[model samples]
Target chain A: MTHAVSNGLLASDLVKNFGSVSVLKNINFSMNADEAVGIVGPNGAGKTTLLSALAGAFQLDQGSILLNNQDVTEKCASARCNLGVVRTHQIPKPFDGMTVFENVLVAASYGVDADKQTAYQHTLNAIQLSGMEHVANRQAESLGLLDRKRLELARALATQPKILLLDEIAGGLTEAESVQLVDTIKELRRQGIGIIWIEHIVHVLLQVAERLICMDSGEIIADGEPQAVLSNPQVVKAYLGGGIE
Target chain B: MSQWTNSVTIQRWTPSSRYAIVFAGLVLVLLALAPLFASNGLLDRLTALFIYVILAAMWNALAGYGGLISVGQQAFFGLGAYFTIRIADLGLDPFISVALAALIVGVISYPISLVMLRLKGGEFAIGMWVVASILHLMVNLDGLIQGETGISLVSLNHYDSAQRLTIIYLLTLGSMAGLLALLFFVLRSKTGSAIQAIRDNEEAATSVGVKPEKTKQLLFVIAAFGIGVAGALWLTSATTFLPKTYFSVQWSAYMIFMVLVGGIGKFEGAILGAIIFFLVETWFSSTGVWYLVSLGAIAIAFSLFLPKGIWGELERRFNWHFLPVGYQVVEKNKINTDKK
Candidate 1:
């Protein structure tokens, strides 16, 4: 893939709250176009919330996000996606009434406002890349869990995203299936699509992610090279209460 | 961009579909010349059938593919009818006034939508009905509306029953065909794709750069436009325009019945449903109130047993579209092959 004109996504001092409860607390994050960052933490550590903020799913209380050096905190989710920020739900949200091909075709056509031929070409590429060509015409609701997850990835990829925010796409998968998903993520990372993946499967994440960040209570407790950050005492303490997992 | 790509032919219809096209075209030709041979009474029934189709198609497009269920479409229909007579009274050409009335009603929907679209699902349906009620009351207040006392179409007095029915029949056919074609093509375009996405899941659509509000707004206005024009034509043919009858909620009820019993999202379902409805009304009118009751019962039965509507059921079983609009992907080499 051709290099993006600027560095990838950047978020600074992001704070978000739902009513009286704060979900994300003063989080600062950044990723380069060539990097894959894995986020590991205990349940409810705000990893998904952080991803949501970046994805423009919800407005933050106070924060700024930059995409390729342009401020995008004010942009809506659709606009963010058009600017190449795409996300997949933890539970797949495929357009149920549509065929798998149509679900992805919507992304290809609207994600970048591509013409018919370009959208068709992009949809084909995305479906093939995510290994969904076999069931391309099947109604999305008919897909099993594994195929649904693959379609989620395919839909995101169809947008030609520069950054993919994956939220536990590996969740509920068998070991072999998890490894297969890792392979897809690895391929995307190799193609220079920056990835921010929130996954509990540390080993699978390790295969694809070049860096690791651990969060606790909506704030990152550790961030650095994958192995080093995973070995950090703060992260260890956060994960297992002062014991290593 | 490439020479090899130039040799590719984008397949639009299958062999059977091509045949269906020819047959449908011939039928349209026959219908266009219908007034030439048909009696006045038959021509009148045909005009009523045409109006029902126009209304049903508008409702289906809005509630089906657009996912904007609105019972308020009568607001435009009533507004269109009233505007037509009023504009005709102002000494403008009666033909041009109907078009103008349709345009005006469409404009009115822009603001009405701002207020009505805030409600979702069933609430949206009710909200539109409430708006129609307001329009019904407001039109009744106008002196020109003659309230329930009514007024005649100034243009009809210039022509006899045969000429008038012929003119209205021809006009209704042209408008219904034109609007349905436009709507069908729209459903095949990118906007159709986005509308379907919004219908499925607004959040997912937003993830892929579709603005749900903007797309829904477009559909709401388009529906208003078609219903508006249909209202104008219906009034033009009827000659007598009573605000109470013109702005009746029964129009909305009929529209909902047609689409719900026909198939909500599919194009042909609306047409088929309208045809069935027209047949029922004509054949069973001798039974009086029982006819309306039977219509209601059939609609309920269809909703329960054939939830997808009759045409939708047929399409599912046959895997076919009599009027294909929304696009489906087929591999280039397997273009002519049917899905299993």
Candidate 2:
């Protein structure tokens, strides 16, 4: 399938630290518009931290993050959101007391410049897209795991972001639910929303991401086509069992 | 064929049980008519209860809807009383002065919210307490407010005792009902949904495009205005303004207790809590330390076992709410004129 003209995101020498522990070290990467990239890493490899820096949830200890061509490294999360960059938490943090519909309504109204009627329509569409119509009025806290993950995606989609950062959204879903989620991601890609999925479900990532990068101790060890990156000697050593060739 | 019809039907299908509305209406009617059957002392107590309802409602709006649990709302209450008293000293009618005082308090609260909004969670609660203390100290030091001796509302002397008391009681009831109606309208609006979202999850709300600071500031100002009006009305009913009475932390504590026991996020909960609170206070007035002990015990019980409060628990169990906040979609039937 042909992709949209690539207005690639660029990060040069990204560095981040949590107190004395460095979580990301001189990380460099770029992805064109409509590109679907996946990052796989061991537990402490800073996959989530990198997503946070790119989403502007945290100030980078060092490095520049450019969306398209503009520097967004110093912007706050909301500011970056307005620039069409949005992220979902790995834990699926839907507003606990708010209903499923209300959650998306807020994103549609405030995330973009849509007016009330337009925002409402957009929110309804997002709900339909996320397949949350059955429980639209239910309190978010009352939802089970699968719905919570769907709510997380609905919220991100409502923002109408150009680039989406998804963090472990499939971590706890059943295999069938993960397949359904992967289909949803594929559907989003069909609409031309660039996606960066961080997942422990490596096979699902392989199904969706055209390119994959494996991280070990905060730095990318391999970046290439999915199969090639997964089978790279360094990736096999870092992720695959020690006995594997 | 039109989308609005579909939306209306969707809303109708999710109707909360009608019993909640009937109960809320029953309470409003009772409060409105209470003055006719009660003795003067009881009437005075009822008036105090009305003020408490408004104060508790404001606190619920701030903490329940806005997710801002303020322990310092009494500062606005005291400021409202002091400002009303000051304005009445210049010969304005006390009722008009109340409105003016609320406006002033609202304006002042915007800047105050700017500083306070910077703090989140525990820090925000502590900041409000500090603000309350500073205001309490300022009131105590001001010679014009009688420097802690307090000031008697000068205009109360102009009218006969009965006339003054009746007018004050009616004004308090009117203000309470009016504020309740206003809040009801606001919570039904699009902005109210945003506020609820913020309360649910600040980050999630922000991601969806809800500007947390703006929504919070707006609600904070409205709460401050409403509480200020309640404070002014309290002063008018009592015919005096005492710093200790107006700015006391106990007022905040009482408001919190009322909301917690009535229901934190439900509108009817505030009124229910206020009524129960007044009755408890009246019955236990002579009990002294036991009264304080009982109050604490009841509050703890509600928080621990009935976190939804009386109305909230009732609503959850029975699926009831007077003013609903979710959307409903309507279905349309098309007509054919084949015979014609």
Best by the TM-score measure: 1
lDDT of 1 by residue, B181-208 (tens): 8898888888898988898889989998
User: Per-residue lDDT tens digits of candidate 1, residues A116-168?
Assistant: 88987778778777877678778999999999999999999999998999999
For each model, chain A TM-score? 0.95, 0.95
Model 1: TM-score, first chain = 0.95
Candidate 1, residue B177: Cα displacement in angstroms equals 0.4
Instruction: Report how far residue B3 has shifted in candidate 1, in Å.
Output: 20
Against the correct fold, how does model 1 do in TM-score? 0.94
Docking level for model 2: acceptable
- For every candidate, the chain B TM-score is 0.93, 0.89
What C-alpha lDDT, on a 0 to 100 scale, does residue A160 get in candidate 1?
A: 96
**Could you give candidate 2's per-residue lDDT for residues A1-245 as a string of tens digits?**
11223385788889998989999999988988688999998899999999988888778889998887888888878888888989999888888877787788778877788887787777777777787777877888999999999999998888898899999999999999998889888889998999898988888887889988889999999888888887788888886564222
- The value of fnat for model 2 is 0.54
Error of 1 at B23 (Å): 2.1
TM-score of each: 0.94, 0.89
